[model samples]
Target chain A: MMLEILTYPDPRLKEPSTTVETFDEELRNFLSNLEETMRAGPGGVGIAAPQVGRFQRIAIVDVSSHKKVTKHHGRLVLINPEITDWDGFEIAREGCMSVPDYTGNVIRATHIKLTAQNENAEIKYFEMEGYEARAVQHELDHLDGLLFLDRLVSRRHDLFQRKTHQKKK
Target chain B: MKNWFMLALVGQDRVGIVAQITDALYRGGCNLGEASMLRLGTSFTMMMMVNTQLDENTLISVIQPTAEKLGLHLHLDQIEGELHPHPEPDVKIVVHGADRAGIVAQVTGELANAGLNILDLETGVGGSDKKPFYFMQIEGNATQGMEALQLALEKLKETLQGNIDINLSPLETFDL
Candidate 1:
């Protein structure tokens, strides 16, 4: 089942998701749907429960198929994810499905060590860097009711409109 | 019916400029749309889109008193068409080198020749006054795509010699 992705200006997207305290079969089912929704989107590398209007802290990330990403965790299902530590910083441009018309330059940690729970409620620790780390950070932000617009490094210099290009004759 | 106007205000840096201007607009029942306000050196500048029922002359009259009190140079133009037009910037370009002449002209000229539309550009001088460093960041879009745009910038970098550094990268975006 593919979930409906909430776009910008939807009040639900701004509301923080509650922690997932109970890991059950239903939770597993929703995670599967979240993955489906992610795969359905155009070039979507990740998805979060909150994006589907589910007020639960759940997110999925998979950058294995991305051409530029040489290394990744394949697919990551993070529940109640927390970044235990992060190091370094880099500014890169990003776009979100929620905010489809614009992209912005954002500064994010280059590397991170995080702890999260799997579908079976087993705690897992992981280290991520480069594009994967950036992807995880972007998904985690959705759990907190934050968007890439909120993380823009410079409001004046960083924000840009995503315009469609017309092929020249 | 609401009329739209582009408003520009510049004045020496001081407190209450924004407050006074905004207060006047509020009293005049004018609503602000998109606005950018910043301090450059010892002066403050503001550009804003204003929506109001007042005509051009009346709107000018409303803001003139506040502008005069604040010692601001004011310009207001009645504008037509969409207030928000989408700007497409497909690539991000950063250039830095020792301060010299023709950097902006040469870079922009190359970009224009490559059929790239510059959406946003900002340049600044840093380092010591004795050894000033110039840097510019440009966001642009090209009809030919990122690969061709990168090639053009590379050629321009070579032409500028070793004194200037140019970095061009596509705007990387991931949907989530």
Candidate 2:
């Protein structure tokens, strides 16, 4: 079943999710719903479980089919992921399904080396950059129950109209 | 507490728009606090923060008809509640260069190495092949004990080979 996308200011979006202790059928199903929800939302590249009314420590990211941007390819199911190291800073415009009708310019660690448990229950460390890295950081923030608004630049110059500034896509 | 309402109005530009809206506010017992208006082409846009603690319903009701009669699209909401200001300092950086490969990676790579938190950023490429302008605006805060902020910005300026300017300033807010 496709997950329902949550909009901004919904208290459920702010509740810290419980960690997934085991990779089982339920976890796999949650991951699939995440994929579906991400694809369903307008301009969505990643989504977390909390965004779909489930406060579970899980997120899924995929930027492969997003126009000319070449990012880390494939579906990334991050179950209790954590950043181990970062290599650079990249600033980009970010939008969220929960925060409808607004997008902000956010600075994020551009290159990240992190570890996460995938669907197969294998713990893996991966290094990602470009669009993929931005997507990962955004989704991970959702797992912590923090909306992008919480980390926004807190300045007018920090936000923008997404339609006028959309990158070549 | 002063319960102020922020109202935005958009409609064709002509005389009497302001007087009409303010007249309704006067009748409704709302006092204007802060206001700004501008003309966009044939349309005029106005925004005001009106104090209405005693009777919000009356203020909204009075202005609602004025807006309708004037063919204006009006929106009214309570002023944003008190928000704790972020204490960290901020800087704005602009990166511009040829639209080439790995420009963002090269610049952001330096930012990551320095442990700065990017608060906001936007990037785009324009112009033509002979003279392309890859522009980006980055707002970030530096980590403690890092090199001088200017020094770090200058270092990025040199590394990316893009014309860079860094401005350290307080937080900002404005309407479109």
Candidate 3:
């Protein structure tokens, strides 16, 4: 079953999610629903568990379909995701499902070494760079109850209209 | 029983202006709503929507002294409880080109004339001083529909001699 994506000001979204301690059938089913919800969105590149009203440290990112993404590892379901180390920084416009109708320019690390658990509770680690890295970072922000607006470089200058600034597909 | 008031704080940029004023409000039990603070050129500007049971006279008296001590110009205007005119901008317009005067006036004037409401507008000038660049973005509501508004803005953009990107559809956001 596809899950409902929570919108902004829905106080539940702000609640810092609990870490996933067990990898059971329920978690698998929820992850599947997350994948479905992400794909259902037109040009959706990623999604998080808290967005669906589940306060858990789980997010999924897939940038392979984003024309500019040259290298990607397909669907990435990051459970209890943690960014061990990051390098470099770049400012880019970002939009979130929870905050409809607004997008902001946010500064994020260009490269990241993220550690997360898989469906079988196996710990996995990967080094991601460029668009894939950016997508992963955006999804991770949800777990911390922070939106692109909160991380804007300058609310006055960096916040932009996501629909028009679609220079990237 | 809550009363609403709009407050403006404008003066030389300082470190404690917000802290000083917010402390005053906290002492008087005023809840801050929407607020925008900015620093432009030499002056720092702040505007806030405050709600409290305190009367205008009493609230002003409490804040006025602290504001004066902070060397900030303060103005307070009571907003009627029922006369709220909040307009949410559904369209986003971005303009970029040569820097000069009247860009804002012309663009906003036309929008107003078209019955569109400007929700938020932010503009800046950058590039070499010899050849400055102007950039503007406005979140607005175009009651005339998307196509109509797009055509109207297109004409204005052409006339204004700049690149204007009009995003009529509300942007979609995703979480997680």
Please list the Cα RMSD from the true structure of every candidate, rounded to 1 decimal place: 8.5, 17.3, 8.2
**Which stretches in model 2 have alpha-carbon errors above 4 Å?**
A154-169, B1-176
lDDT of 1 by residue, B9-111 (tens): 9999899899999999989999998788888879999999899999889999999999998899999898873555656567788899999999999988887
lDDT of 3 by residue, B49-74 (tens): 88888888998988999889978988
Candidate 3, TM-score vs. the true structure? 0.63
Give the runs in model 1 whose Cα sits over 4 Å from its true position: A7-11, A155-169, B81-85
User: Model 3: residues >4 Å from true position, as ranges?
Assistant: A1-26, A29-57, A60-136, A142-150, A157-169, B80-90, B113-115, B126-133, B161-172
lDDT of each: 0.86, 0.73, 0.79
Query: Which tens-of-lDDT digit does each residue in A81-106 have in candidate 3?
Result: 99999999876557677776556557
Report the C-alpha lDDT of model 1 over A1-169, residue by residue, as the tens digit.
Answer: 9888899989888899999999988888899888988988876788888899998999999989898888788989999999999999888878887877677778889999999998988999999998999999999999999999888887454434457698999
Q: Highest DockQ, which number?
A: 1
Model 2, A1-169: lDDT tens per residue?
Answer: 6777778777888888998887788777777767876787775568888888888778887777676567575778888899998887745556677876556557788789989888987898899987788888888888888877787673333444355765876
The TM-score-based order of candidates, best leading, equals 1, 3, 2
Docking class of 2: incorrect
Give the Cα error of residue B34 in candidate 1, in Å. 2.5
**Candidate structures ordered by DockQ, highest first:** 1, 3, 2
lDDT of 2 by residue, B1-176 (tens): 36878889999988999999999888887778657776766999998878765566666688989898888998878876332333232555666766778777777776667766786666776798688877776777766434655566678777655454434443321100
TM-score between candidate 2 and the true structure: 0.51
Number of the candidate with higher DockQ, 2 or 3? 3
